[model samples]
Target: MSTETPTPFAARPGFVADEATGVAAHYGNPLSEQRDLAAGRALVEAGHRAVITVTGPDRLSWLDSLTSQSLKGLAPGQSSETLLLDPSGRVEHAAAVLDDGVTTWLIVEATEAEAFAQWLDRMRFLLRVEVAERPDVAVVGAFAGLQGVEALAPNGLPLVWEDGWGEVAEGGVAYADEPSHPARDWTYRETLVSRDALAELASSPVPAAGLLALEALRIAAWRPRLALEVDERSIPHELDWLRSAVHLDKGCYRGQETVAKVHNLGHPPRRLVMLHLDGSDNVLPAHGDTVSIAGTVAEAGDEGAGAPAREVGQVTSAAVHYELGPIALAVVKRSTPVDAGLVVDAQDTAVAAAQETIVPPSAGAAAGVPRMPRLGAVRR
Candidate 1:
């Protein structure tokens, strides 16, 4: 890791390198200019989804019964990741859930709201849970290095703060109208505040980073996000999602059968691994690039890389960090050689690469691979 510290921004958490500052200095025109705080924010809002809140007394028990993570024990101000699954154990939706004691808030991909809400509604038979979509809420994120900000949540998930960040608690749990920022999977609402105040609170003048930067940071930390790191055909074990989202000891849910069986007795069909792309040029392999190892290909498309352009795995997310160079998050078959040199066919050229395990083998990954754990798992 680079020992240099980043530059300081008033509201931003971490330091921005001089080079990074120069690259992001231009914000007015996105197309013709490099992205700055304003531009990055605009792009992030446009490209990514917002936060969705679910209110009512039955929220916790309701969501707990439907998702993989154990939410029954969630305190008033705690949060955690939850994975909704298909009957066969495939991932349907994943969200950062927040429990504000009375209500539960879910921060998820925008496109997933309708489907997830419908599913929740359909499942709400005699349960006390009331499922409604709260688009009125805004979602914001700050990098890990903010100084002097205290986090609101008890668990203090990484998504809540950067390395040096601290947070201030604005309101107590009982004050529904109090302004609150729940860390990681926790959610809170403030009806007393106007939209303007909410907007200002959510919109800081910090250097806004794109999904690309976020993706790079996420992949580096081994954190998996939906759509990019997960697929419908994939099981929770394959992505090591169980570590944070699935509670193995937790009671039953839709996919619990497969989750238990596969975990206790069988190996997952595939494994999530990180690839360090080699070669000089900055060309990043697209999401579906093929990976090759020892001239044999195992999986194809974005699911896995396949043959005669023989592939060992497929790139799910790839990025060139200002510091980490070119890196990727990929899912490869367990059969692929860990020590074997790998290559990615980015467009027409073959880029050399190395593979590391971010999620350990016991978490459904293959043995002897270097795995990076999800972000927040790191103890401060």
Candidate 2:
């Protein structure tokens, strides 16, 4: 493919919102656009929101022993999600770890590092491990048909790509693998590129997509993200996050007991579902909106005008898709009658909603193996 610079949004028939932010006006019905792989110019390195580096001879083994996922299998140039849990198994922080063979880099939410670092430090008495925060090494995101990779680490902050689908780097060098996967990161040496180079790279230009578009792609692909699908009360099973993150056979770690019990014997209380909204209405329900069965509205609006239009579930994240119209991902009580009609109140408008299960009923179902459950209520 030709590597010529892609057309900027300004040259296109879109309105510019402001000069400082450079946000483009998305007037065309978002639902009418095509859903396909984005192409064109590459993205710039805008520095990561948070960065944590783990060093020391016992780094790999130490981390493997503590995290919920199996870290032993990770090799250089690989990245995976791992969760840190309290003694009782509640998640403390979920992180994306990039292991480049020598050093392991963790990118996590901004608010999570202090607690995570303190926890790691508390566990690091005899082990030969070192944990440090490197705010100097900035993280950047790039898309488009970019080729080649290079790193500049004059200050010992090496930049490398964790490699999934797309090429990403800090200082011109690719870090990870091709076709970047969700939650991937690239590390680079801090000094390889100068301030001007960084600014120029940041201005390289790519489609300015908001979190909504990103969430839609993530939900459709069944990828788990924090705060949206994962909550303090949520178990990993509910989100189907185990596909790549959880290791059932791994040795005991914090919360492993609860994880095992829920996975093998008990059912998660709720399951994640994709909500296809009634596109004709153009109504998008806010998060935490009640979903109710059809025609169940109380007289005089006693239950709050939009009280979960049948209590099948609540929306976790929603966005008006340029192609899919108004789409939402929600968690519903798994025991809710699957065939029951569901609706959500979008302010004054009650929008018809349909729930499609994204996660199977049980882990046995997940493996394509058969397992029986106690029979419950049956509808005539």
Candidate 3:
């Protein structure tokens, strides 16, 4: 689903480019490599990520006004994320942000880098901020990359933006309150490197992983990547993204009205769920598969007396976890019951799934009352 072509990996052997990112999809055995990486034995190629830099005193304050997160006080080396929403609050872009004193670094999808930089350039107004895309800079990811990030740092800005989705950030809300969240060990970090640096790593003694390995860990942790989870109708709440990428109390931003209205008064139209797939057929549902209850929808003038299967969700991403077997992350209607039995349509086959709720249906109704019209006064 990503438009990013993989960065050049000329020094790596046995890796093959089979995805849109053009990076290796696997180095022969993806499952074994998944285990190695999960056990902290490997690093994955993040050729799909792109880096952008915003320099000037106005960088932090200017970016704070344009995105969802509050970044006025973001200190150097602090990692965060921000979402650009359309006027309707649908997520248009997501950026992994890091401040390095003199500059603000934006780590975004390679496919989105140019456009994102251009957009920021146009938004700079009379501000001193200077936005630039760094095509010379590529990315590499590892769970323990932070400890060695200094060694991997490039000359100008050795940006190392840690992934903070594992826990709730300050001033954010958590919709998923599971005591032992499956992704508790999801400690991932990305390092910016020169093209030559990535090539050197490709030749290093350390083992390299493909896209599949990264995806398995991410899906198992219930993480939502914009390239995979976002559709035209996507909003931050549906993916439980408010837990990290959003600042609920942040002052007026482009889509703040919609964000507040959805959080305070209305429930998100849909919610995120983890699906334990019944891999009896050893088949995985591809992205964009329709999800329905485990039965068939009744059609008009239908002869069947029982209700027909109705689509309640869509499989956003699917993978085979080293521990969880086959699993998927899905976006379902909020009203879909938490205990509902689900089936994912994999073209010709319908794979069964057990639902694990992420964002509950009653998620935003904290006031515990029916919403009334704003213009009219309360009835006496």
lDDT of each: 0.57, 0.56, 0.83
Give the Å error, residue 224, model 3: 0.5
**Which TM-score value belongs to model 2?**
0.70
Steric clash count of candidate 3? 6
Residue pair clashes in candidate 3 = 6-21, 296-308, 296-309, 297-308, 297-309, 298-308
Give one digit per residue, the lDDT tens place, for model 3 in 1-380. Answer: 13353444534766777567777778888898887777667777776788898999899988889899999889888899999998899998999998878888898987778888898899989999899998777777878632333333433556777888888989788788757676578888887766666656666677777889999989989989989899899989898899889999888888888888898888999999999999899999999999998756444577774686789989999998888999999999987889889998897787989998888898875556775678867766
Ranking of models by TM-score:
3, 2, 1
Per-residue lDDT, model 1, residue 31, is 25
Worst 10 residues of 2 by lDDT: 168-177
How well does model 3 score by local distance difference test?
A: 0.83
What tens digits encode model 2's per-residue C-alpha lDDT throughout 153-181?
Answer: 44354554332312322111111122433
Q: Give lDDT tens digits, candidate 1, residues 34-71.
A: 12321233222212344555666777777778888778
TM-score on alpha carbons, each prediction: 0.69, 0.70, 0.91
lDDT of 3 at 91: 95
| Clashes per candidate (backbone, < 3 Å) | 30, 40, 6
